[model samples]
Target: MSAAQLVLDLALTVRHDGRGGVADDLEDAEGLTAWVAAHTAELAEAAALPDPLAPFTADPAALTAVRDLRRAVRTLFARAVRPAPPSPADAERLLPADEALDRLAAAAARVPVAPRLTWPEPGPAELTYRPAAPAPPVDLLVSGLARAAAAFLASDDRDRLRACHAPRCVRYFLKEHPRQEWCKPSCGNRARVARHQRRHRADAL
Candidate 1:
């Protein structure tokens, strides 16, 4: 997946609970740990991690840090799609744009990495980044997420970023087509049903 996808995935961790409420996928340490493991490849690619498939376990502190980053990411996501309303998850309590940008930048700087040049006999030379200092995997994960989010926000792909306002969904999705509305088919179904209901109620009155 592209780096922008990784950022969208992080923001989407907060989603509808199926019972008509919002839910956090990383609500606890176990959840965070599992989420990290499931998306290791994306994290590694986005963060340029040393080991592409190394296992990662998140602790309570890591969970807290990730949630904080999530807040900043979501807040910026809200701003990226202007004129349109933001996701309902925390629209009223979103951090200021400046604060969110500062937090994201701070998290990304937590682990410094420098590019190293390398070449294989049959391949062109490429630069692979190496961390300048020893840091915990959790720290790398958070910084990687922040960096990916920042990159996405600054990219042209940000134009496709959208907030799915369908019913109970509180997700930020990348619009795949000009005609696309909701994040998924399920959300479209919900929105259509809601529109039908409103018309029916109007007819009843």
Candidate 2:
């Protein structure tokens, strides 16, 4: 997946609390822990973690940190989706996210990485890349997520970021097509059905 999509997806794992006006899954540590575990493989790949560490341990502090980061990301996206220009208050509200991002960036920079040659299907051409050594699980996860979000926001692809329009689907998606509205077909159906029902009610009235 594209970095923009990955960042948006991470923000979305909490779901239901944005424009959708639904329940929050990351309301507590347990929920956050489950989210981390569910997305472990992807997170591992993004962090460039070795296979032996297939699943990262989800501790309480990590859960708290992740949930907090997710909230900041969501807030930033929310502001981006708003019709009006962001006021100073909006910037003030994003203080936590800003601070967290700075810290994560610093932590990521401090981590030591080694350059390694990688081959695709044992081909003649080898790719050289620097990969981080195993570090604190929380640090790795947070830095990776923050960097992804930072890069996405800084890229032109940020223009494609959109919040799902379905009534109860609190998802932010990278709009794949020009005409796509909802994040998925189920959400589109829900929105259409609701619109149809609303039309019926208007007719009855």
Candidate 3:
């Protein structure tokens, strides 16, 4: 797994939670921690790649960097649903998600590549050399994740993405089925019960 793959995996996980409703807070820190832990093996596999440039070692520092980057990504997604007015501290605390994607794109562009070359040879013989394109970098992965988020946020097609209406389950999910709601049926049931209770109380009054 490359850094790019790790980021993409995180993107999918983040999108999974966005199904019910946009999470407005890190209300379930335990859940978040568990999610991160579950992905650790995948992250380790991705971290095995060689360093991006010379003088950079892919060691503990790289692992730490990836973890920090993922954490930042989580925070950005959390903030998107419940944005607070930008304070100086807020700006300093987290990388703006769009900016992070842009940075990733820029980094991806900087990856070295060998251009294809062709040479004419005598008597209709020709020689050519072409370099294989490098695999996508982490930045491109980040950009893709950002695009997915944007699509979910901006699209009017309710069928593509939806927020879980279940109480306290503010997660987003893709609507794979026409009747799907609340990411899981459990949440749906909870929502129905809550609704029923509210209506019952109202009728009593």
Best by TM-score: 1
Candidates' RMSD to native: 1.6, 4.8, 10.5
**TM-score per candidate:** 0.94, 0.70, 0.40
Residue pairs of candidate 1 with colliding backbone atoms: none
On residues 137-166, what C-alpha lDDT tens digit does candidate 3 reach at each position?
343222333333333333443234444556
lDDT (CA) for every model shown?
Answer: 0.87, 0.65, 0.43
What lDDT score goes with residue 165 in model 2?
62
Which of candidates 1 and 3 is the stronger one according to lDDT?
Answer: 1
Residue-wise C-alpha lDDT for candidate 1, range 1-205, written one tens digit per residue: 7889988888888988989888889999999888888788877787676673367777889999999999998899989998899999977869999999999999999989888899999999998676777788877888888888888899999999999989988888999999999999999999999999999999999
True-vs-predicted CA distance for residue 126, candidate 2, Å: 8.0
Q: Measure candidate 2: CA RMSD.
A: 4.8
What are the runs in model 2 whose C-alpha is more than 4 Å off? 17-30, 50-53, 84-134
State the TM-score for model 3: 0.40
Worst 10 contiguous positions by lDDT, candidate 3: 48-57
